[model samples]
Target: MCALRTQFRYLNPYELHKIIINQYVLKQPEDIKLLQRNKSNDRTDYHVLVDHHRFLWEDNEPKTWEEQFAKRYFEKLFKEYCIADLSRYKENKVALRWRIEKEVVSGKGQFICGNKICNESENLRSWEVNFAYHEQGERKNALVKIRLCPSCSKKLNYHHKKREIKRLKKQSKYKKKKSDSKESGSEDETIVCDSSEPESSESRRIEADIPETSNETPWEEHKPEVIKSREEEMEDYLQDLLI
Candidate 1:
């Protein structure tokens, strides 16, 4: 492929971008030629030039195509050299899966709500926000604990669902636009937005029924009031005595 484009010294941004994108496919091994000769080191090197910035493969032999692709391929190569990030936004693929566990508070003495605005200690529960992220190509699991009162927990869950619905809708919209452009024979490579997987039926239902601008939730009207704990009353008595 590099030999075929001999007319140009190095591939233009679009040509190089396409090749990098195709490197994700594991089906075929990439055939790269070591052409450039380094006189000082007396070694032949493989070089790729983007916008006059040369990227040289220092090794004498090019590694397998899979090994060539880095975990931070988008940031390192695409964004740095090709200027793809200027016109096109790459979808962030972190924390797609989460494992949230909520447990009722037992034998607690006035636990402050983790919500910055809400300080209610009544009906407190411990919520663990567990998710995974890739740092330097290693997958790391993170667990964050937050103690929240019933009302705050409900509010958190409600807002989370709302945001999730919006995300699904935005992905669907982008996919529609991409497909439409493809059918019209004017495919826009810049619009590379798509969901990693299909959205569930429940997500579709929420997107259809829930209005993004609405501040109100369906269960808010019937939300149970948080009863004051005996520990709270005892603490209040102690404060009164201190006063």
Candidate 2:
């Protein structure tokens, strides 16, 4: 009996709900842009539909170029995607976009949560959480999937969402503060430039050429007066009368 690929069968609800539905992460699955230009057909674009696309055709040599390409693709998948850790796939060496790992044993089995801080080994059903982030024109994108226990799944989801919100808030605050400072600086410059009128050299020269007013008292204008004591005056009057 030929044992088929046991990878896809017996998927849990969590496994079924991955964003990219293809068993294999074929490039540009539903790209209408290529279809408009007729650059690609359905089979070529969505290589997952090709039978046993995940299996490397081990003939001595591939019959056609398509079979050869499929063989090469499956080999690459085995070498790169067939790994225990989802975090390493996002690295430059691997660069796997959308893929799933085999499920853990059905019962309560020991597995480590893939959260960075809390990698607590626990007995729970583990599922791979896949997500990606890329800005519009960004060349480098972050493709990530973390195996999570039930508790850590919730915690990590909350953590990622809250962390993103916090980062955006900080960016907003920083931008607003920077803009306000620039506006204030420009306003101050405008006030300074418009407010003060510099005194002209002609005005300064006229003021300097004018004669200054004098504050000193003239010595010729003041008269010296003689002082007489009361006793001396009375004695002098009596002596004049006697004479």
Candidate 3:
């Protein structure tokens, strides 16, 4: 039995763009430009120039086979690049596989998501994953990549914004509370000083007016008591004679 051989025909530029737009959900024209610009080869200028030529092309403009061939060659390269890039998406495993199986299938590729402990099989549209080649050592290099589903991506962005808002609010509240506490503490100190100032002054005046020692001696204080006793006795004798 003979092994099955599939025909691999190259795609034209317009067909390639249509496929990208239809399958990958790339709606914006700018996104296509970005994708082309990010490719390993520097064909962004050529692609943009071709797009400009196509835009200005009217029925009067002569169509040449050479131009068509160049467009097809670039289109094939662009498609291949897109397929390889999109296959790196960790979330779009099914889509990536479909794209590879349908469009371009060279070999198996692996994809890991930015999320912790997330790994998935590569798909056709998975090339949309952002990737960078990191050189670990002289000869050792690794591809660092990140991928996300639309929902997960949106949720992550929203949480990041929410955290920023919460952080700002907390800082504002802390500053306001700190200022209020400082102001209140200063006012309390001022009130305490004002209330104690008059009392402290009166205490000092009383202390200053106090005599150091008494003028009378102990014997002089006792002599007054003896004189009073003798007068009392004479008064008693007179009263007895009158009776």
- TM-score versus the correct structure, for each prediction: 0.19, 0.19, 0.16
**Full-model lDDT for every candidate:** 0.45, 0.47, 0.41
How much is 79 displaced in model 1, in angstroms? Answer: 36
The RMSD of every model to the true structure, in order and in angstroms, is: 38.6, 30.5, 31.6
Candidate 2: stretches off by over 4 Å:
1-43, 52-56, 79-243
Clashing pairs in 3: 85-127, 86-126, 86-127, 86-128, 87-126, 87-127, 96-123, 96-124, 97-123
What TM-score, to 2 decimals, does candidate 1 have? Answer: 0.19
Q: Arrange candidates by lDDT, descending.
A: 2, 1, 3
Candidate 1: residue 62 lDDT (0-100): 29
Tell me how candidate 2 scores on lDDT: 0.47
Residue 13 error for model 2, in Å? 55
TM-score-better candidate, 1 vs 3:
1
* TM-score, cand. 3 vs. native: 0.16
* Model 2 clash number: 0
Per residue, candidate 3 scores C-alpha lDDT tens digits across 1-243 of 122112113666787667667756655565555555455656565674454332112244336754564444434431222222333245532221112332234332323232332333332122133222322222322222224333334433432221211113355888999999999988885334455445588788999999788787888856755445778989999999999
